[model samples]
Target: MPAFIPDILAAIAMVGVAYNLAGAALAGRWRDTPAKRPAATPSITMLKPLYGPEPELAVKLSGFLDQDYDGPIAMVCGVSRADDPALAAVPATARTVIDPARHGSNAKVSNLINMMREVDGEIVILSDSDMSVPRDYAARIAAALEEPGVGAVTLLYSGRGETNGWSRMAAAGISWGFLPSVMVGLATGLAKPCMGSTIAMRRETLDAIGGFERFRDLLADDNAIGMAVRELGLQVVVPAPIVTHSCTETSLAALAAHELRWNATVRMLDPAGYAGSIVTYPLVWGLIAWIAGACWWVPFVALLARLALAERIDVITGRRTAPLWWLPARDLLSFGLYVGAFFTRRVDWRGAQLHMARDGRMTAEPETRYP
Candidate 1:
């Protein structure tokens, strides 16, 4: 390697550490203050799109129904198959739609399109199947939407790993890698992400954006929905009070495959921003610095900065998803996945092989798509 390579690598590592420290400061400033509940609550239709059985599916599903809202709650759930294990977990109070309607390549969007027909509430909230929210989730969502110029409300979600080691690693990836990146983006006004953790919007707002059908072919459908909302001159707001997403991938392969797809999706949405995020991994850059002949103390300081960033995230999220010893491995794994994402436009989603275009549209392989 060139003599200057070590110096360059060490400098990059220092930049990454500074970037993480900035993110930590931003997260502290953006801490969520509790929203006062609206005096008049609008009835809400919670749309849950399910594929198969997941760990703690029942508890997660019920979290939506057992909300503390005063308005009538319509929990409408859709499944591609009647035999889906998720069907058994659906509360009897919820209106279950087992429709095999393949509206487009995105099955989740198709399910939302189907479930929308039976919606009975003035406000519609679309959340993924694996999230667990608080009892006052409905109230907070309602209050957030009532804000002027806010077209949609999306919440941040922390990861909840199951008993398995791989599951914990996946959770760490979320709490450590994904969550801080979002906080940094939010603070810098670089990212306007609409997560599947929870998307609360009025029915009229949904219609104005052309509904779920508009995103039927998009891979990053949640962000696409946010874009549509923004096109109508509306803001997609991300509030505090993070939800919980079950991280139950039992194997490293499963975890890597899932995160690779996520990284690819973000890359498609904002290539420049995604490229700039390379500086978010101090540990990876730190290793490169050491290998390139940087002083040992340089890597040591970088590692300490990475740990401090992780601890800050844990404090913000109120969950210790990644242990102190696990930070280096988690950061390296995330950096590797980020690099790998650029080489492939294909993703494995719920056992389906999906081909993504540069425009973010997705099409599943015939052999892998559910019938």
Candidate 2:
């Protein structure tokens, strides 16, 4: 390697450290001012698509049913298979839809299509089964939609570990790594994210977007929905309240596969931005620069910067999912997964292997091998 390479690496690491500090500052101010509650609360139907039974499934689902909103709120939990054990956990107060119909490669979207037939409320909310929201979640979402020209509302999410050590590590990645990056992107106006954590829209907006059928084959279905809404000359807004996403990975392999799928989906959606995201891993780059004969304190400075950012996120989210000592290992593991995502487009989803096309469409295949 050239002697100048060490200097270049060190410079990049310094920039990454700066980014970490900037992200921390941005996160402190990222949340929007709480939207005032509308005078009238419209009826809401929350569409929760579940797969197999996960850790704390019952507890998470119960949170949605016990909301503080006064309007008539209903939850529709859908499963593609009749025999899926997750059905047992669905609250008796909520309606359950067991549909085995295969609409496209994405099973979750198919579940939503079936659940939609049973939706009776004027407002529709599509939230993943793994998420748990606060009592005011419905009120906040309903108010955001009532804003002028707002097509949809999505919530930012922090992570919660419900299972084991692996789950905590996964949670740390979301709270410390992913969440900060999202904050930076939003602060800079660089990302338009419509996450599945919570997608609240009126019935007419859902109909305008073709009613979930158009997203049946897309891997990043949430983003596709947001894009379609944007095309209609309306904004998809992210409100102040951050929900909780339960991390249930019990093994290293499961965690790796889940994050790799996420990384690959982001890469496919925005290749250039994903490539530039290398700067998000300052500790990894700092260590590489130190090994290449940069200043001895470079890696230590990176570690401190990362820790500062983690502390900021914890303070903002109001809970720390993993110990601070575990951050280095989590960061290294995340960096490895980031590199691995480029080698293949194959991703694991609910015990199925799917190949992603450049156009973001996914095709399901036999479980022959793992990436």
Candidate 3:
């Protein structure tokens, strides 16, 4: 059994090589758009779903209000109550809706659905309250949203840090680990992801999927929405990745709570795909071989594999240099989270407790008003 370990390592190295090669191609293809003044500006509605004010919330809110687009933009913010501290300094053009009405276990989508009634524009760009983007955000979204045969357009994000060690790790996990993986999928035509960070679809197409109301109970509502759009034979396009979110988990527990739920959600949504993700972690597998003292080749290949992915991701996302050694630490932690995911069948989101089933829908434990 110990002698065969090198064989396993070599096979795992193959997965690593495939991703790095694909990531290199993806990086080359991941072009950044020059800030072109839009030829013509179309009316746009920025749909924002809010729970409460998070760290740097005000600054994030300002990104949308400060856009340079030549189109009429309506900022629609919704809260579960009349006074979600998030309401304090929202600019006037931004409309606010207060509705405690729970549409389902997915509160964010519920909030978005309530706010959707306020939209009056040719293009609808849905972004989360904690997310921030550039001045060209609106114009870029408009171009993608206007494309024929497009159902949705979502952005890829990197971290905006708060100076904590673990938070940076989590952020790196997203920027280096998650973002490039998504880009690789996009380049290979192997993915259709519509993220809450930014999902701009025609108001009409949103209705065709039965709206956000249809995703009220889905755990991976973003992925489900994207799939629904694809079912309609339309592509969910993600052009020139945009920075749209940040990490706020300060403690290890906080990080685990935040990511574990996400892990379980993804596993539930794609069990086979989730199982295949084990190869994404070379450190843990290499450590197993080292602890057993079977083959020196395992650790050597693992180190090479991880560093290659990191380098590829750095170039692809235009993200800065990471402490190369920290990649292994992040990979081990991610592997731990992936293992915990299989055993976790419940999720706690936005102060709401939910039980995850084999399918991707969440059932509230105590049962919320909508569940």
Candidate 4:
């Protein structure tokens, strides 16, 4: 190796650490910003797509029904199975759509297509079943959409572990890994992410995007939807008061499979941005510096900077996500996933094996495999 190569690697790693530090500071300010609650909340129809039973499923779904928004709100819970366990949690007042119809390979988008026909609200909200929102979630989202020229509103989310060590680790990955990256991306104007965390848009925006049918075959449907909204020359606004995404994995395999699918989805959608995410994992870069025979101080400073950034994010989010002991392991795991994403397009999701095409569409594979 060239003598100056290790120094270059060390420099790159330090830049990544500094980036995360700046992101954490920005996150603190974003988190402290006052929630923008709507003055007159409009009628809302929340579309929740569910599959099988998950930890805290009922408790989390119940939170959606207890909202404090002044407008009339209707919840639609869609499931493919007639005997799906998710049905038990559906509030009696909320409509339930049980359809086994397959519209392309994306079950969630198909579920939404079926659920959409029954919606009757001025604003449509698409949130994942595993998320829990506060009583004012509807009002805040409605307010965000009412902003001029904003076609869609998406909420940022923090991970909430339901049970076991794996679950907590999954949650930590979101808080320490994903959330900060998203903040940095938004700050740098490098990302436009529309997430199932909470996708709020007017019915007209949905129609303009060609409705749920357009996303039925896509792997990164959330981002695809965001792109559609942007095509109409309108912005997708991400508001404060991050929602809670339940990280309920019980085993390492479950967590790995879920995150791998996520990594593949994002990488498929934006290859350049995904590849550039390497610099965000400073600990992994630090390990690379050590392997390249950089001086011991190189990795030592990198680790300390990584730890400092993690602590800052933890304080900003009011959660202990990256404890010093677990920070290195998490960064390595994240880096490994990023590498794995380039090697395969197959993902295991919702008890099915699916192959992702270069265009980000997914098709079912005959046999299931876990990464």
Please provide, for model 3 over 37-107, each residue's C-alpha lDDT reduced to its tens digit, 9 standing for 90 to 100.
55668788888887765777777887887987888888898888875777875767689888888888788
lDDT of 4 by residue, 1-371 (tens): 89998888888888887877787677865564656678777899989998877777878887887887789999899987787877887878889999988898888898999888889999999999889887878878888888899999997887867888788788888887888888888888887889989898999889999999998998888888999999999999888778888888899899989999998888888888888887887777777888998878767877887777677767766777534688788778878878988887788987889988998888975433222
- Per-prediction TM-score to the true structure, in the order listed: 0.96, 0.97, 0.91, 0.95
Q: Can you write out model 1's per-residue Cα lDDT over 62-173, one digit (the tens) per residue? A: 8888988899998988988777878888888889998887888888898899888899788999999889988888998898888899999998877879858888899988
Assess the local accuracy of residue 149 in candidate 1 as a C-alpha lDDT between 0 and 100: 99
Give the Cα error of residue 293 in candidate 1, in Å. Answer: 1.4
Best by lDDT: 2
RMSD of each: 1.6, 2.2, 2.9, 2.2
lDDT of 2 at 264: 97
> lDDT: which is higher, 1 or 2?
2
* Deviation in Å, model 4, residue 322 alpha carbon: 5.6
* Candidate achieving higher TM-score, 2 or 3: 2
Q: What is the C-alpha lDDT of each candidate?
A: 0.86, 0.90, 0.76, 0.83
